[model samples]
Target: MSLQFDIDAVLDRLATDGWVVIPHAMPAALTAELRDACLQVWQQGLFHEAATGRGDGQARRAEIRSDSVLWLDKVATLPAVAAYNAAMDDIMQAVNRGLYLGLAELESHFAVYPEGAFYKKHLDRFRDDDARTLTTVFYLNEAWPQDAGGEIRLYLDADCTQHIDVTPEAGTLVLFLSDRFWHEVLPATQQRLSVTGWYRRRGGSVPW
Candidate 1:
């Protein structure tokens, strides 16, 4: 069955549950292209191990690189990524009540985790700043297994306790409030590939 994109419904759900999962926001071919692009970057030795200092003795790994305007521009030239971005813009606009007027700055990055690699509990938004209002994660694995781990666990409270875990599914788009939500990625049994970034309001920006 084909998937539907419902911005209002998703925003409502996110407001209530602190997150929302929208299936197939991208086409299969486009997803493959983005995945390949990320892999190319990884193979070229462009990524580094992600920093982990906020956890309580939990093992994890992640690599983050910014300056995605060029990367996103390249991907946007492709029909699929462009279409997905357009749809995403609409959803983001709806979520922010149209505060996203004018061109939206899109930041993109490739997150890869090999076996036993994971990201501990953390928040996407900066403590001293609140410009990043929305965050999006696009899964690129073709058939991600639930048991393979690398699922994102979003905390419901300030102490990082009580939460919901989400499996990384290809063609699936997950969006949430960046500043208010706390989350983490579990270690993966196999390599996990994904593109994650945020849509901001262009003020009080924090480079990360």
Candidate 2:
């Protein structure tokens, strides 16, 4: 995947609007491989119902979000997943250099939202945990139509009025400041697939 994006411009967007979107960030072939990997995981029953919160508070609640996820290892058995992890590591270095963010690691997972699945608006990072500094989501749904109804809506302010919606299109990448934005996944008329991840300030050689 030799796709390139304006890294400086994207970082500037993160500084200003707290979020940025890059269409076709991943190469078509690579995106196809990733999509296939996700579907394979689903078929193999490798995903678990997504849970909210952390530690003891973590629990699955269908009412909040009905998605299945398989957390990705930085060094995955799948070649495509390994390539993406390496790419993200490079981007992470660039981000840290530009912002002086002491990001130590990243954790990612493939998420699937079936029909009638929605996630109520919420912030990725809790007020008490500032460790989660950045969030990234890459869509793997090819040819997602406008009326397919699954769009991640990003609220611009505390009141949740001003917002922007993004489609679940293959190769599209979304980056945002995790603590600043409030976002939600709308019900999908069809299944929606994506790899969502977080960059953390946590230490050690592994992602927390």
Give lDDT tens digits, candidate 2, residues 8-58.
897788778878999988778888999999998899988889999877789
Among the numbered candidates, top lDDT falls to 2
Model 1 misplacement above 4 A: 1-4, 51-84, 98-104, 205-208
Model 2 segments more than 4 A misplaced = 1-3, 203-207
Could you tell me how far off, in angstroms, the CA of residue 58 lies in candidate 1 after the best superposition?
A: 21
* Backbone clash numbers for all candidates listed: 1, 0
lDDT of candidate 1 at residue 115, scale 0 to 100: 71
- Write down the lDDT of every candidate, Cα atoms only: 0.68, 0.87
TM-score of each model, in listed order: 0.76, 0.94
Judge candidate 1 at residue 87 and give its lDDT.
61
Candidate 1 lDDT by residue in tens digits, 1-208: 1235766677678767767878887768778877777777677776756543323432234343211212455445655556656766666667667333232555656678777767666778665555667788889898888788878887877777788887888988888778778887877888888877777766554543
- Pairs that collide in candidate 2 are none
